[model samples]
Target: MLVNAIWDFDGTLYDSYPGMMKALAALVTANGGQIEPKTLYRQVKETSIKQFLTGFGQQVGRSVADLEADYHQRARAYLQDIHPYPEALAVLKAIKAQGGHNLLLTHRDRSAWEILAHDQADTLFLGGVDADLKLPRKPAPDAIQYLLRRFQLNPAVTAMIGDRSLDVDAGINADVKTIYFNVDGLNAAPQADYQVDHLIEIPPLFRK
Candidate 1:
């Protein structure tokens, strides 16, 4: 039986892209750099913030630190405004009801997504580890490994779910079941143990 869940905060649970896009756009524009909406969206969906900012910095002739500072400053104010998918709370509650322990790991700052978690459904998460924790980010397996070891969870009973390929890679790296929340129905899917189109679809997989 599935006993634990490691969730990805940004795209998997919360619809944070719109706010993130605005933050990136405002930061680049304020820095006198122009980034097309399509370019920003594709990169954000594909890579880490640091990677994107570094590439963007090179493109715009600014320090990554400068772009990053502006982005984070702008994002903090908009963080609380992010909302989960309509099915997110229902799925979280369902997992808890089935005796699964839910944990969250994200690249977002601890101060940012935590507000939305409290505002939406705080009770569903057993714990959350974020960038503030100083743990290595996902696709490295450090954070998830820490959670599994600390909690004494069996790897076989754990599943990681996220919308990005990085999320899948993290789970695979950690040797747990991985679920790709393919909301976009992309023709080229990530390598995951399972794939679901929506949060509501996840519960049935665990039930089996």
Candidate 2:
């Protein structure tokens, strides 16, 4: 009876971390700070983009905002390489076919929709809240609350799927079930209603 599925963009529906990591690597190099790809990935994955940028800024004698501005500008080139996770579209279509409304909840702005549109996946979503809306970021539940009210989604029948702990935390705060897309095998699991390593495993959870 899961009638609504709220998805996270990067690392969840789309394999965007590679592009984002490349952009960060290039940014670090341009700022005369060296970072290995694996090291950069681990740091960003374990912490977050903002945390990574904060430390990078200090190392390069720049402000976080300045560093982020530069990173976003550089990211555009790399981001074009982004694509959906394997079976991600299939899972989305399955949800839709089962009469479930798929929605996006992400910190990314228009670029997220642009990416989904390129794959024609944008049409599957009922609606979403993006960063441009200026809602409090995930783990806050403000954006998810807005979606619940606007879409008349029942929290009991809504599930939030995301790759990060904050995403699960936001879903919990919003009073919905959470599915943690644990692409990497973390020893300590987030307290999600369900956990899966692949997109193909998702649709079964929502089946009647």
Candidate 3:
């Protein structure tokens, strides 16, 4: 079976959570606040840093704008830590070798292009739609819907893979098959067509 894909960049294809959480913890501490990496990370999983920052500002005694600026600076500083997860590239290449369209949909900003390009994985994608496109964020189907039409893909043969429930929800909203990359096994029962504990477990779910 031929397959087309939409992948989430940050946590699914990459192990960016540790670095990102550490950055958030540092930023919070530098501003005279106290938040552990694990605590903030979980909050972010349910919501975005921007959204989380609204209330986080009050707790940390800073303005939302200031907090956002701090986050942007820290994110750039931590870019080096955002390497591709082991075995992720192999799966993507295997699918591409089989004549699939692998499109990346990430909420990560345009700054990610430099990192991806540096890693030489940017060209592996057919195309990418990210924050630069200014689409509504996940749990909203706008971005996926656009990709489906742009590629003229059949929803049945396409899959959206990501590490969070929002990713699964977006794929569900778009009416495509969803694969949740629950590596930690925390998502005991994600509302996805399939659940994978590793990136290498992905290709078999669709390529067959």
Candidate 4:
């Protein structure tokens, strides 16, 4: 059966890690604490900025709110660095050619799409719902359900493609197939229906 796929934007579609790391490092230093770039990157991936900074502030002597504001300010320019992963655009094109329906579901603000929409012009994005929308982010299934209802999709034939465990959980919660795109088995989520190392491997899954 033909399927509709919902993709996660951050680590899945675009490699925003480098820019995120840069922004986070600057944020840490600006708040009078010193943290290694790699360490900051890992922390950001594992926890949200508010929680991460709340913990960090306790270690140093600062308020989480101040640190968060600084991080957001420093991260403005970094958003422009967001770019598609290698061959991701080509893979998306192939999915479109196969008559697969595609949509984007992310925790990022809607404005992030204006900067991140490159090469995705051909896909049917229902626009970003954003974290501020108060809709539960991935792993809660709210965003997935919204997409399904909006697009009139069948959960059984639909798929969620992403690089994190949250993506798999979201798909499972929404009763859809989950495709894990972690090439190195970095994220070992139990809900995944298929595991692939590269974007090019996606097209074969639709084959009869």
Q: Per-residue CA lDDT of candidate 3, range 1-208, in tens?
A: 5398899998888888887887788887787888766668777886667778888888867899899888878877778878888897888887887778788999888766676787777887888788888999898999999998887889989888888888899999999989888876678336888888888877766564
Q: Model 3 compared with the native: what TM-score?
A: 0.90
List the candidate 3 regions with Cα displacement exceeding 4 Å. Answer: 60-66
Report the Cα RMSD per candidate: 1.9, 1.5, 2.0, 2.8
Give the alpha carbon lDDT tens digit for every residue of 1-208 in model 4: 5367688877777888777678778777766779877667566554455667889889878898787777777777787788888877776666667777768887777645675555545344544456567787568888889888878888888888888777788889988999988744456665689888888888777633
lDDT of 2 by residue, 1-208 (tens): 5789999998889988888988898899888889789888877766678789998888879999899889889889877789998899999999999878899998888999999999999999999999899999878899999999999999998998898888888999999999998887662236999999888888877755
> What TM-score would you give candidate 4 relative to the actual structure?
0.83
Q: Write model 1 residue lDDT over 77-140, tens digit each, in one string.
A: 7776788889988888888888888888888776645565576676678886788888887788
Q: What is the lDDT of residue 9 in candidate 1?
A: 85
Q: What is the lDDT of residue 91 in candidate 4?
A: 69
- The clash count for each model shown is 0, 0, 0, 0
Cα lDDT for residue 156, model 2? 95
TM-scores of the models, in the given order?
Answer: 0.91, 0.93, 0.90, 0.83
Best by lDDT: 2
- Report how far residue 4 has shifted in candidate 1, in Å: 1.1
- Candidate 4 wrongly placed segments (more than 4 Å): 46-51, 57-69, 116-128, 183-185
